[model samples]
Target: MPKAGRRRSAVWACFTENTASGKRRVLCLFCHHDLVANPIRMVRHIVRQCPNADEHHKKICREYQALTVPARRRPVVGGQATEAAKSADALELESARVHSDASAPPTE
Candidate 1:
């Protein structure tokens, strides 16, 4: 059973206890396929790969996947030079130019 406030996966509905293995394994209600009590495999089986799975089961499995999977961070473009670093470099260049101009004697 899940904790009082924690979210539970809807894909759990597709699982039934394996009578032979007891709690060690679960049987798929859709295709009667036996699987170990592994959440990743269960989700994959129900969501993307299960030919026997119905639309309802797939929908729930997708929901579970969405909750569990962390969104991928987009890769930084063009080597290093992040936006902050680029801005800082530009500011430094501007300040150096200004400092050089200020130090120089006034030209007529």
Candidate 2:
């Protein structure tokens, strides 16, 4: 299907299912090239030409590398943690609350 709005010009892509995550993502096959052309042809062009298209790919690679630092994580500027960490922390809080309530004395 044709993409809508601004992204309408962006390329359409289907990510192969990740074996570990079992999730898929859509992406632009071409580097910095929008999906303005015919969908099937666009997909083909992206596969064949996007990797070496221009400086945009280089920038994307640099950004991706920066985001994947293992030694240190980015500071939570607004207290927003990654989704996985947030879910685990929520579970811990829930368990603590349950235990506290369960162990407390009964009241009239």
Worst 10 residues of 2 by lDDT: 9-18
Clashing pairs in 1: none
lDDT of 2 by residue, 9-84 (tens): 2233222222343433233433344433354444445445566544554454444444443445545556777544
The TM-score leader among the candidates is: 1
Per-residue lDDT tens digits of candidate 1, residues 16-102?
A: 878696567888888888888677678988887677898987887888788888866555578865555456678799799999999
Q: After superposition, how far is residue 68 of candidate 2 from its true place, in Å?
A: 12
Question: How high is each candidate's TM-score?
Answer: 0.55, 0.25
Q: Once model 2 is optimally superposed onto the true structure by TM-score, how far is the C-alpha of residue 99 displaced, in angstroms?
A: 0.8
For model 1, state the Cα shift of residue 56 in Å.
Answer: 1.3
TM-score quality measure for candidate 2: 0.25
Clashes of each: 0, 3
Residue 1 lDDT, candidate 1, scale 0-100: 62
What are the lDDT scores of the predictions, listed in order?
A: 0.79, 0.48
